[model samples]
Target: MKTKIVLLPLDERPCNYLFPQKLFLHDDIDIVLPEKLGDKKIPAGLKEIDSFLTKECKDATGLVISLDTLLYGGLVPSRIHNETEDKLKERLHILKDIRKANPKLIIYAFNIIMRCPSYSSSDEEPDYYEEYGREIHEIGAAMHKSHLGMENTLPLDEIIEKVPEKYLNDYISRRKVNKALNLASLELVKENIVDALVVPQDDSCKYGYAAIDQRDIRKAIIKNCLEDKVLMYPGADEVELTLISRMINTLKGRKPKIYLKYATEAAKSIIPLYEGNMLSGTLKYHVLSAGCQLTEAYEMADIIMAVTAPAGNMEEAINQPSKYPEYYAERNIAEMFDFIKDRLSEGKIVTIADNAYANGGDLQIVRFLNANNLLMEVDGYAGWNTSANTVGTAIAEAVDAYHFGTTERHQNFLGLRYIEDLGFCSMIRQKVVERLPEYGMNYFDVRDKEGKISELVKAELEEFIKNELSSISNNLKILKLIMPWRRMFEVDIDVKYIK
Candidate 1:
């Protein structure tokens, strides 16, 4: 018999919905999703999701849900929702009823601690955030410090005077409701309605509104003695995939052991941008969340994770100097490449977690892999978005490969990461963004997703692969490419690989 798991993704984005489905294609697992998950900024139909969960979960063996979607429509809507606290609580009760209907279903759920972007942008925030976003973030940090009786570097009163009272009040009000929802989800774990729960801090920092919420959530977990059943970490988009790996491991009674290999020991202590904790701290939760253990002995490990940490401070892919500075000169890529090579020779499932850059893979790492002809030899690779996002994704793929072994689908996924994470993010995205002004477009508003901007990107990527990444060019072809959300931030790519 095959395992059937019903998923309610964080949103309708490809990372949340499509990635999980593709990962399970070669396995005996059936991942069932709701018919309609809505668009960016637009909430999915609550009635449709509830009905789908109630129906499909009855026969399913497990359920992986994003509580943000169930409580506030979707991730973006969670930030701007105007629904009252009473109404949101009423919606949360729906989970209890589902548990009643499917008594035997193993429920795994996650909720996000709302993010506070350092820069001002209304693309995924309120209309007022475009103007006061940075000020709002500063104000939140000041307030959090004041509440804890810490010294305030930025004058809170001065910053607060800049924004209108109404918008600040509105932002604080929504955060209160969302934090309450996070606590309520933990109660589900205490009640055994949810077998496991993860409350991911989305795009977090060391001191801010999100960190304050994380502290409160941690207190509740300890207070209720639900420590083992819940995990709070610095990740958002990749939690669904992590839970899916856990579910598969549980079904097969497999707990894979993973050994961490960092480019430099200092990389473990350095906190990547947009996150609160160090890379090592987050990796522990990610490994455990996927139903895996970290091993000290390489000979006893099932997966060898080659983590490419930054030399010193991490920088965005576009801003990196053509010749990196001395501060960014500590990473020993040649040594890391050799380690991967040696592991692959020993028939180990080696995976690469490229965290050397913020928004893309390290081009140097890609070139090394290509030069050594190890691009497709490794089991998994991911380096996009935040460091936690890349680490969680890489760990999930490694877990899947460990259990199922390599397959044609696995090879395609590996190729997709190289194309999107390395090729588009590091190389093509900057080129496309530069050309956007010529086409009367900007980064946020690319006009048309499949128009000239995308065509330019496709052409540049083809040239880049042929010239730079010829190792996998013959087997990989771009089947489709579009700016998902019609922005230069990310691209939705479809590719075909022969081997």
Candidate 2:
């Protein structure tokens, strides 16, 4: 009999659903994803997804779901749609029904602590966000501080002084409605409808309205004595994979023992922009969240993780190396070498989180690993978006690899990780963007700014990716690079194994 799981994702992003499905694909395990309601489509899509769940998945060993998917259709829909407050609460019935139908089945679900957009951008936000977004975000930050009994550096009068009164009112109104809905989900935990809950704060900062709401939710969790089962932290994209890992652990009746080594001690405190708290705390939370344990002694580790950070204070945002001082940070690179070699030689399954840069991998780290022929020795690697994104994703995949993985599939996955993080994003994306102006196009032409990149630009990126990733591995071929959403914040790789 197969160990089955039904996963409802936050959105249709390939990374959110497809990657985890692939990683959990074993002869004995089955991961099922229901059809999605198109982005921004609400009640109808939600009904369809729920109906599918009711009809299709009954005997699965566990279910991993996103409340955002059920209530709002997708994560973005949760933000942009104008669903009424009462109607939103009505949807919790679907989960209650699932629980009634399968009383003994384990359920894992996640709810997002919605993001506060930084700029006035309607791309992923509501229409008015393009103008008052920054002010609205700051207001939340100031309000968060006040709730915590901390001094607000910026007075509320000054924070929203420039915004139109109507926009501020509407924004606050929306936040209140959403916050109410999030709180209501806590009741589901009290009712024992969900076995575990993940509330990852999207686009978090030290202080904000979202942070303040998280405090309230944290109190509720404690009040219910559901603290161990509900995992809330500062992350967004990678929670599905993390929970699936935990689900797998539950099914297997085992915890993954892991060891962690960072490039520098400061690497532990370097707060990647979108999260609150230090990097070290987030990592420990992630490990336990995945039903994995961190070992005090390296000898006991089933897997070893080497987290790479910049040697000095530098952010790896752009490809222009000279624009930032400490570009390579050779000191950190040397440290990573010793770390990886030390662990790998000890027969520990090693994974790398090359966070020396953000929005892409550290080229210098990849360059060193490639030059020294240590790239293939590692079990997994992830260098996408923020530190939590990379760390959560890399750790889940690495833990899975340590327990259940094949050489061919693992190599193919690692190749895909490097191809995206290093080959395209770190290097080729900038190259192709540079060529866009020749076609009267710009970087925004291929990125999330405007919807659906031009076919010409897409074609150009495909050609460049082939050149960069063609020789990545003998076992995996560069099948295709796709913009699943037709914009380039994230791309999907169609990897075909060598026959």
Candidate 3:
């Protein structure tokens, strides 16, 4: 019998962009989505999500319940808020109600990810909240305008002082949300409301918010819940999606082991690693960003890991525009190279991809990396450095473009970060999970350090590769390799998109 799974993503953008729809491409899984969840509305109704659990998911054998989606109104905001007892309690009641209706169905739930609340503008403006107090006041005014339509913008200082302690308290409540979600995940299991929990490995979610470390809180929740069934799986979004899909394919006839391969060729254009004196802070953010370790130390290696940000003027590269003139003149490539070549004498491998954001005299960064034998690129679409989104649709299109052959679609890019540290891994994992049914793999449960995942998630990852590796040649390998490397580790490269 075909396995039927239902996925209710908490946020609209992530729900549509990365989820089961993309995950099931490699499998024959039948994934069901509620009509309300699909509505163009920004916030998926709580009632709508609950209706699916009671009405639609009632007959399904297994279901994945993203608590973040079910509560907090939306995904980003839910994670972006401050946690409090009241707020946490409010969301938990909703989940409790859903579990009361279906005690037999296996439910996989996740605690909401905590994130610092901040906003960005597409115009490339500096994140003003860090620089000026007025920008924050403006935000408060906008909020007031939206809710109360107050005239005469309140004085910035007045608003700061007058904003109700309650409202401001709610705005910055990470501690409460963390506690609430932790308690809910455990309580649900204790109450037998959920069969398993799937916690994603997302620590940065709280970096911008309060000082609380969610890692510890999640571990405690896992211990309190039944350890046998409450598996604490370690996976990001991208990894989760792939793992989920792998589960489905295993049930199908796909083989269980595979290796990733790159589709592009660069015989004549190999970027040789520069073997000379290494510059402390020169030759690409790709290289500079990776400088957390000893620079002189890396020069001695056969391969060097680089982290280049978007292309920009050597001026912008050397100094922040916010501090332009003081350090601006130091942006000379000749001067920068003089210091870098000395370290290159030490054998190193420099990985790179030209970022599109830097303001520079020319695209010399890639040329420099190439001239010095220091370029390795990963395959994937990458326009944003910190905000890389895997265009699953684009990847699907690329797959179709190549007739499922990695070599056919040679035009690709490398990831700036390593696989393990990438934030986008979760998104990719979500997509992979959504696609499981087609491959006949059943995700009995999925969890991370946060919750129902066992310590065997890595084994599960290996199992996934084993199952789907042969189905599409090295497609999974390439996707898995490129997706995380660029997102987590920094490397220098020649040009942004090799394709």
**Which candidate has the highest TM-score of all?**
1
Tens digits of per-residue lDDT, candidate 1, 1-499, equal: 6788999999988889888887665557889998888777899999999899888988899999999999888999999889988888888787888889889899999999999888899999999999999999999899889988998887889989988999999999999999998998888888888999999999999888888999999999999998889999999888988999999889889999999998888788888889999888999999999899999998999999988876567788776543554224677766777777888999999989887788888888888888878888889999999998899889888987887887777777888889989999888898878877787999999877688888888888888888777987888888888877888888887877786
TM-score of each: 0.97, 0.91, 0.43
Report residue 199 deviation for candidate 1 (angstroms): 0.4
Question: On a 0 to 100 scale, what is the lDDT of residue 481 in model 3?
Answer: 24
- Candidate 2 per-residue lDDT over residues 1-499, each given as its tens digit: 8888888888888778688776777778788887655643233276688777887557877888888888888888888767788998998888888888889878888899888866777667777888888888888887777766778777877887978888877777777878888888888888899888888888787777777878888888888888888878878788988988998888788898988877776677667756776777888888988899999787888888888765445475564353433434433558667878888788788888776677788766676776666666778888888877888888877877867863566666777777777766776666666766665655434544233344433465455445543444455566655656544466777665553
Give per-residue lDDT, candidate 3, residue 360.
19
- Candidate 2 steric clashes: 3
Pick the lDDT winner.
Answer: 1
lDDT of 2 at 417: 79
> Per-residue lDDT for 349 in model 2?
86
For model 3, the local distance difference test gives 0.37
- Stretches of candidate 3 exceeding 4 Å from the true structure: 14-19, 25-27, 38-42, 77-104, 117-167, 173-178, 190-192, 201-216, 222-243, 246-499
